[model samples]
Target: MAASGQRRPYPQLADSPSTASLLQSTETNHRSPEAAFAQGPRYSNTQSFTSSGSTSWNGSPTNQGVLDRRSYQTNSVSEKFSLPADPAVWGSNVSPDFQEPDDWIHNPDPKRDRKSDRGGSIVSYRGLTNLGCLVVLVVGLLALFAGYPIIHYFTTNQLSNLGGFNLGGINASGQVPEMIGNYGLIDADTPSSAHTYKSFADGSEWQLVFSDEFETPGRTFWPGDDPYWEAVDLHYWQTNDLEWYSPQAIVTKDGSLEITMSEKEINNLNYMSGALTTWNKFCFTGGMILVNVSLPGSSSVSGMWPAVWTMGNLGRMGYGASLDGLWPYVYDSCDVGTVANQTYNGGPAAALSGGDPSNGGALSYLEGQRLSRCTCPGESHPGPYHSDGTFVGRSAPEIDLFEAQVSGGVDSAGLSQSAQWAPMNHEYIWDNTTGNFDIADSSVTQLNSYAGGVYQQATSAVTKANPDCFDQNTGCYEVYGYEYQPGYKNQSGYISWVANGDVAWTLDAGGMVADPETEINDRPIPQEPMYIIANLAMSENFVTVDVANLVFPTTMRIDWVRVYQPKNAVNIGCDPKDYPTAAYIQQYADAYNNPNLTTWTGDTSAGGYGQTEPKNSFLGQC
Candidate 1:
């Protein structure tokens, strides 16, 4: 995360020499676990293998068997060839005049030394010189052995860090594995036929940074208006959608928050529904986000475009800001807004006839997404002709973990048995290559279905044909996770899309999208802090009128929304098995599922203009 303007005191870095010396001195009384590291040929210790007084045992040196310099006589060949008494050795004879033996312990055969000695009894010092070199070599090796891994893990910034250990807790290989936990699986033993669930081998220690189990109202929020998300009352929320967005559409009870859409008259508006957002009330730089959900709406309902996504908070202002988050530092024609399909502002938003300003709700909060437009260089899309072009759609750079365009078509296979049309599950992202929102870096992926056992391989276009994975109408209960800005060996980040505890696919910083012609860096990789927005959009008239006008009680049931980071943590209280959508909702069908006598704490003012819920409505999970 870019450092906030706030200054904080940090620990000083250790001086290199001092740190190396300290590492070398930290000798252990117990045998070293790194015996192999120390004994390698390049790191051979200078100490001798055997001492003169002790018989060869493990064939290694011991202080107890070291020769006594005071009693040693070089005249004896055994004494001469053995450890030639060293007065300098600790506990050995300390006589200052004690002449160190020459080739006594090193060369027991006098004939060998006589051949080299040109002057009276002089001996070659080569062995002694080499031993000295090895001593220095060992010191250098120890310094590198102790310090390199730590430095490499932090500074080198390797890509493997994304899947390996770089954050959270260290793994057996000393790298932080990319995955931390698992969620959403129906069959215990599905064939390892495709991709089976990948377990967190060492288990998870990731701390829950944010969680909205939907038991109680959360920190202040809403949309349409904002000192932060004020109660939605989202007038004409977007694209002439029929539904009037109101807080009533949201119900936080029975251990879950159910957002319902129905045909009802509200404030003179024809249809009514709910929407929730964390706008300014909460936003984070990077972390893992999970939303356990089940789409209860019929795909036959046509216009239902339910989504769970995260977008850059800068909105349209990021186009002109500097890295410090200050907007308008650099002026571009696109900043004010662009001509529909006309200018070279960055993307084809103008050409697409999508997005705000051109579509009519310019100043609205949800319409502030200019960052998701198509900005490929040299590609100029003509104006859509209705208004001035900026970004063409709700193009703000985002991580769309789960967005279903419920097509109302079912593939009769596996769990579906017969009656459900599978909705297309999508995962879309922008590579933010220019350090800001650029559409050239954008790519969209759509999965065929949310089949229960589809854990391993992503359900790509080719794989979607399998009836087991794409059966949609039977909206299955499942977990969706988005790991954002994962660490890289280069310190840059990427995003990973996970389904049922296994990775579906991933996108890196320099990733290429569908359009290969554009340079890889043309996309916008969202590095800015982002907040979560989970809403069921009618997509405003995008659905056929028949589906839009269809029925009542249309709903998007969410089990929970949780955010976690790499850290020490404990499990949340809700048990996925017993407290499933079926049991929990079924058990509390008659009465609201309130918490067990505990007081719920949150913004009581935002709710209950005419009513209110108990403090702890349902969940005590944290």
Candidate 2:
């Protein structure tokens, strides 16, 4: 805290709870969770600790960052009780167990916990000795069972010191308090007050597993992997546009990285830029992925199409063989150049003879038409569609975080592409989830602006559509978030993306906006991991005219990119609709306590929703 200009307040031992008060709280709060959503096959229980006398750290407990799950006792001398002070000790937590370890002699372990039915069980208390010690412990137990509201009130509404940087739990209450430092995760320090903390928006403790701060400048990003990035060195690549990508186009200079869009005559060709991706090697399923980038300071290369995007691997099993033919999945991206909003299409599409199918300047039949669902009968491609209004598992493939038409018009209200400009604001829609791949779903909405007063959700699409992110942060830095789900949001898996402390967007079950509508109940959801790509291309295929000045150099300056997931856990599955509220992400936190032990799924867009569910069906028939 001192490093960030903020200092941790000196603890007042006199104001602290008595040792007996803490021990009692531990016993009363020993009730287990509703159910154990085991994260893995078998927990190692490798964590070991010894508590002696009244203090926390005593004997030799491994310093691997694991906390002693057992309760701390005052009477149990020679017993070392590990307290939750550091972030690693917090990660060492596991749910109280009803069953013994994989190996045992016979009787159920006295320390085993069996009360959990749902929610997250972060700690466990077992060993207690003597009547005096037990009596002192009972005092603390009374505080939890009887004085819970009072403790919660102070711990939450009081000063940040009450929680120890708001993440520690060794204070007055002496309970296993929530670690809510950065983004509400079990942070060791207040993230906001510390620049050392990356952008982890989800209110959960996260362990940074990957990062590219560009601190070393030209050094290799992912050494020993498939390489820093798989450069897309090709002229006239897939987008019949101009420009050839080269290693020379990508450079890490100054304090940040730059992917400049400039004109270059190469191999008898004229346009040139750079494109790179961490394919296969550094692909991630779900985590807070954010890049602090300032769009080109000047819109000189208006004709250039630059993007920070990601692609799904539906066809990884075999080209077009995975889900029959679902290849591209725009999990979440931002084209800081030219592109029309998918719903209220605008821009040049409305100008040069319906140049932009979405913009109203010259509305065409396709742009003016609005449909409930896509792919009807012989219609192979998807058509205009709107959000289910209810969200119920609806997700967008392309979560365009920040896409702008540099013609120099739209303001930052829409991240420089507000709705007034049509096809320019933040947009999300289920484009093609299954069948014909012809735009199957449309439930599109602009996530950037606070319409009336609702922001997009980061948990489940079936929840409320409007959430508030304005109060999420207090800096000029932009904030966005999103989620990605697998086949069944409840069963398959889901990944969350938080940027600048807000939900950019979510791709549930491998579904993407502008792609097919894939859900958990039914439909085809992605089953493979997706890779990220950052490129500076020419001409966003959606439009024709240039957005920036045609004769100047424009660069996309990215300060850093940080990716993080739950500490000590991977993608743990759960049915948020039940047990806990559908939107409360705390259940997701339970996944950390139980590593590799997830088992709960309802359905996907395939055999469920439109395929089998009649009342809940959005599309007509299977």
RMSD to true structure for each model, in Å: 30.1, 34.7
Model 2, 1-622: lDDT tens per residue?
2323522222224354433333432235633222221112122333322322222233434321123322222223222243445534333335455443454456554553456335443443433345557888898899878789777877895332112212422221122334332221222222433323332234556555445555445633332212334454555333556666666777777756677766678856566677766533344455445566655433322344545655432211111112111222221121211111122223322122422234433322212101112223332212122243221211112233344333332321123211111111122232224421211122322332221101111111211111121111121234333343344444644444444444433444433222211111123343334455676666555234453335535576666665555554433211111111112213233311221222112233222111111121222222
RMSD of 2: 34.7
All candidates' TM-scores? Answer: 0.39, 0.38
Q: Judged by lDDT, which candidate is best?
A: 1
Question: Tens digit of lDDT per residue, candidate 1, span 568-599?
Answer: 22111111121112232233222112211111
